[model samples]
Target: MNVTSGQEWVRGQFPRLDWLPDETLFSLCSRQHLVMGNLDPATTSTAVLGLSEKFIKHDIPCGIAALEQNGFHYWGSAESILLHHTIFSVFVPFQNKIKIEDAIITIKGDRIDSLKYRLGLVSSGFGAEHPLKACPYCMREDVDAHGIAYWHLTHQYPGVLICPRHQAWLMVSTKSRRWSGRFEWSLPTKDCLIQQASSQKLWLRPAFLNLANNVIDLAVIGRVMSLESCTVAATYRKAVLQGGRSASLLDRIEPLRRFHLFESLPEDEKSTESFMNQLIRTPRRSI
Candidate 1:
């Protein structure tokens, strides 16, 4: 029960927390905390999540039943929240059906271990740093339209450095504690922008722009269908063949030249041979 104002707790009678379009579950929970005026995070967590000590994860949060019990059921069912409010859509294109089902079952509960591994995120060589990112234009517009700035699930996707709508580089938060701290529920503001990231402009190269658009499209499409590894590899092969290239010719291309194909990738990734191989190889399962 929430200790704020010495109020008695009632099941499913919690304060109204309407869902914002494309807003993350973390952001929704954070806004609830703000509305309740709780000085301690555990107060809000116990009321909203039915847990007193659970950490709020930005990417893949668990305990959907708890959230529903606390009056967020109108936001949607457990599965609905997982697909609409979390980063699960981004992984759907790569994951198999069985894996996706297991993810749904696990996420509906309170367990967190192995979820990343099952989704292939642990092996993807990306998402090593779960930085809280926000597009400045999005923030300003959201404030104007909705009266508050909230986190968008799309902005937090791995390798998504630019805002698909604004074509502006997303600003990463400089304060780790803002998102990582047990009690902090900081929102986007110009003051939160990382110093170096604030000074930089979007990389407007054609390849960079194309990759950003394709990634956003895939994430949106993944909500309905799974693009299995075999289908993806087949598409690549078809594209190569249509371009008057063969397997042998592709194999003969020098490694540096292959690396050049992904020149827009982060420098750290280009320097890692295993990461490069993973990107180009047709994987047996999820990549």
Candidate 2:
């Protein structure tokens, strides 16, 4: 493939790639130099000299020499050139992870001839924020305080009430002393509250008398649980008593939606909903 053909295919897959500036491509290619170690330091340094010879052989030295001096490397093999050009083509922002099988290159006499390589969408992990720890639910290293608190589902003892926390969820395990679950309080919903409490810093306040009271409650309760779920249920009960919206069967849809990926379906059409919907709507206790 040529540069034109590669660009056309990339633009077709992702419309956003069409607007990237030339400097972005250069930056991507520079970063990928470490990945493709085929060209050693000696070969890299001699690239300009090689290009100069080619220019002289073609009887075009004046402009070609200036271009060669401006960091252009001449590859004797088409494969090497195609490898470099492929890196350049896929350097679009927010797109990474090009598959090697998708690339196109020409070869002649055990050397790479002129070729164009198609670039794929870049990997999403390229510019993502790194977390200090892993999330228990997703088991991903991308967990943050805000992400854990706001995005995760909270389950109660009776399995009737489910909610997402606007603040941190305290996981109390029957066999554990210290809390062994993740916490996120930096999400948009609790950001203002956390800011006001700690002057914009991550803070934890030790409960003195309340800690004793919570221990007493847990001892009498006989079940390990999430504090946030209890709080949400209590709040919901009060709202319902005051003429709020009654919890409907539709509220179960979210959990059902979550399990959809496990549903058994035709091989070609297997998806999240097919498996989960069946499980959620059926009563396992009766079975």
- Encode model 1's per-residue lDDT on 1-287: one tens digit a residue: 35742443444355687887789888888898888888887787777777644555667777777876566678788878887888778778877889889988888777776788767676655553466788889998999899999888888776566787887777777654345445466677788776324324433434444556776787787788887676677676566557544333333332212222233333343344344344446776433
Worst 10 residues of 2 by lDDT: 53-62
lDDT of each: 0.68, 0.25
Tell me, by lDDT, which candidate is best.
1
Give TM-scores for every candidate, taking all chains together and pairing residue i with residue i: 0.78, 0.13
Give the poorly placed runs of model 2, Cα more than 4 Å off. Answer: 1-118, 122-287
Model 2 TM-score is: 0.13
Residue lDDT tens for model 2, 1-287? 99978755643442121111111111222222322342443232233223212221100011222222323323223333322222222222211223222222111122222212222222221211111111133212113521222211111111111112222322322211123232211211222211111221222222212322343344233222222433444665564456423233223222322222212222222332343334334233322
Per-model clash counts, in order, read 0, 16
Q: After superposition, how far is residue 113 of candidate 1 from its true place, in Å?
A: 0.9
